[model samples]
Target: MTMEKLIRFAALAFFSIAPMAVATAQDSADYHVTVTLNWTEAAFPVGFPEDPHFSRFIGMTHNERFTLFADGQTASTGLGLVATNGRVSILKAELGEMTRRKRIGSVVEADALKAGAGVVQMTATLTSAHNRFSFATMVAPSPDWITGASGIVLNPDGPWLESLTLPLWVWDAGVDGGQTFTSPDDPLPVKESVRLAATPYFLHPAGLLPIGTVVFVRVR
Candidate 1:
């Protein structure tokens, strides 16, 4: 074949294959995450109740279209259930709905923490379209307290991060009026926006205590 013709064919082939290669590279990635709870009595001694535990960890990979929960935003009914009662079914259903709408890529759930200090590991898959991770787990024995991260970007500028460690802070779902860890079920007169837990129950001389840390490591 002529050199010009061969070069033209090569150019066409390269263009066709380049897009597929890029797509495959950015299509999806898997990550192994370790959630370490440190809500020990020694770390947070003020009114630390007995049998401190955490509800099952639940999360999802989503894009800008969805958010599990955010500070200053009203908690959805599903999130309210998780915060108030440690129930995950409703929130899982909500995530399913978003998946059907193509707003999410995957839903991840992990074992609950039966003690104040422990670790739960989970694997999550993220897609190029849904590269953000959001998760929550209730701080049991509390009225509507939870600890989790929201809308953490795993792939910020086209490359997935190798690893990340995030500090988990206590948050109030704003669905209950209780002030203590073991406070009875008391629905707020008016539902308020979610915010960091600031009641005396979570406050300390050094500022609010972090409940845990979540570490994400990309495996593939």
Candidate 2:
């Protein structure tokens, strides 16, 4: 099989063979998630384009046994695809397999968003076991810049009573060395993914900063 096919097959096989976790009993609940991409001159360099835009938003509501990406852990090949190429098919397929296995409750993907202002909203199901949400989106033109939250617990101690909004920070997939928005290069796999250093690593002369916000609301 070709490398791409191999990747897809591997992803499918992974979730297929993985054991399902024992779910904890809890009252079922639904959540409305609103993810907004808000970028201003303060967030990115002046040279950032309005066209190419950020890649689609990809995420999953899953149990603690599953996570998409971690701060100091190695990034999966599906994550590498989203972070570097703005592609979602591979990851989506993988998540689909996970959903079938009951490892993930649901998967989410939004269209490519423009530079300044864009919003995508979706609803997700949550149980006591599958109470965490994780997501990611690629920063265009760069080698492997991405942004999203990992392991956001819906209701840690009690039920969510109010809507919550949090600032989203930029991350380096640690898989590429390019520094610019449009870094002309191929994916460079790293030993592992780490939190992007605090130093300015983007087009902004001053360095990197929070580029957006994510809002989660309890609808029922």
Candidate 3:
């Protein structure tokens, strides 16, 4: 078979076996992690917990392996996932708490939230083998505009691979005119215009915010 097909088949096989693989290696796994974050959006009719504002982010980070956002590039794949699905979810987990919750994605189109911006919940999932893996999703409002790694399974990080997977977010794939969000003409984050061609990467912890964004991918 072709190389691309081979890779896809191999990934499916690995996922099929992942249950046992995970059980056996649960303890020895390189990283054991849990992420929890809360967000508030003025776009919502109310406030935190009850108000149900803007968006949410659900992703995973491995030992310096992956990130929801890419760097050097602009924008995020997560956001693209939102607009396409029109709905997603971000699950909040508490260590040993046995409780999980989901929330909405972003609303970059909202006029009220345009100036104030929006708040987003975040969760992350990471793998020990590759820098890529399928990411989680959050759904609430329509026009979903944020998401994280999805079915991500990158090959082991060599010095070069490690160097690439630094802080970053998701972006529209241009599959459906990526940069065409909200309007037919210029996209909101005009600076991100170049990002329409490929997936973006940013090393900033706060993600792309306040315009004039900078993307840096760092390994930790």
Candidate 4:
């Protein structure tokens, strides 16, 4: 075979299961790949506003870089930011799975998702190894949630990663545990909870908090 033809074949065969001829090597090579992902949302029964409820969005960011909770360690700052925002209840994910791959883009498709609702439709497209891949997730008996079949793409020369979003449960900084939502005048506006003057607020958990959810990885 001529040098030009051999180069062309190598470019097209990166993900191929075909055996390679070690003797016939090329100067430089590149490959392409893609992926399609689907996601859904589900919330534990928090009930009506008169009974208030909450949910979460578990995502694997570009290259799956880092994660919040470790097996025996504490949650970090980035994750803490998410948790604070989700006040009522939400899993703050750090990140995980920082691969050699790049982030082309991701998509989130859904009709509508209610706070306490179980399901919301979503989909994503990812590019890797000069090719494209797709997957979806679906939870049974719940329109509020759905996940597609995951098409995994692993690298013989790449990395492994994981990240997650956990369930939401009510929390109140202990100093003012019994405080209700209200208005207070100061240099800054009063936030979510009411004031119990002359007291300090601390971490105090309430309600049924959710367990951690896993972020699935795709191997090419």
Q: Is candidate 1 or candidate 4 better by lDDT?
A: 1
Error of 4 at 125 (Å): 5.6
lDDT of each residue in 80-135, candidate 4, tens digit only: 32333322122221122123334312323233223333434333333333122222
Per-residue C-alpha lDDT of model 2 across residues 10-123, encoded as one tens digit per residue: 999877765442122235567788888766544555565545468888888888878787778877777877888899889888888888888798787777776656787777
Every candidate's lDDT? 0.90, 0.74, 0.32, 0.28
lDDT per residue for candidate 1 within 114-219, as digits (tens), equals 9999999989999888899989999999999899989999888778999999999999999999988878889988899999998776778888878889999999
Task: List the candidates' TM-scores in order.
Answer: 0.91, 0.77, 0.29, 0.30
Error of 2 at 143 (Å): 0.8
State, as a TM-score between 0 and 1, how close model 3 is to the true structure: 0.29
lDDT of 3 by residue, 98-145 (tens): 112211121112111222233332222233433333333332232223
Candidate 2 TM-score versus the reference: 0.77
Off by over 4 Å in 1: 1-15
Collision count of model 3:
50
Q: What's the alpha carbon RMSD for model 1?
A: 2.4
Model 2 error, position 136 (Å):
1.2
* Candidate 4 structure, TM-score to reference: 0.30
Error of 2 at 90 (Å): 1.2
Worst 10 residues of 3 by lDDT: 95-104
What ranking emerges by TM-score with the best candidate at the front? Answer: 1, 2, 4, 3
Q: Model 4 misses residue 25 by how many Å?
A: 21
Q: For this target, which candidate reaches the highest lDDT against the unseen true structure?
A: 1
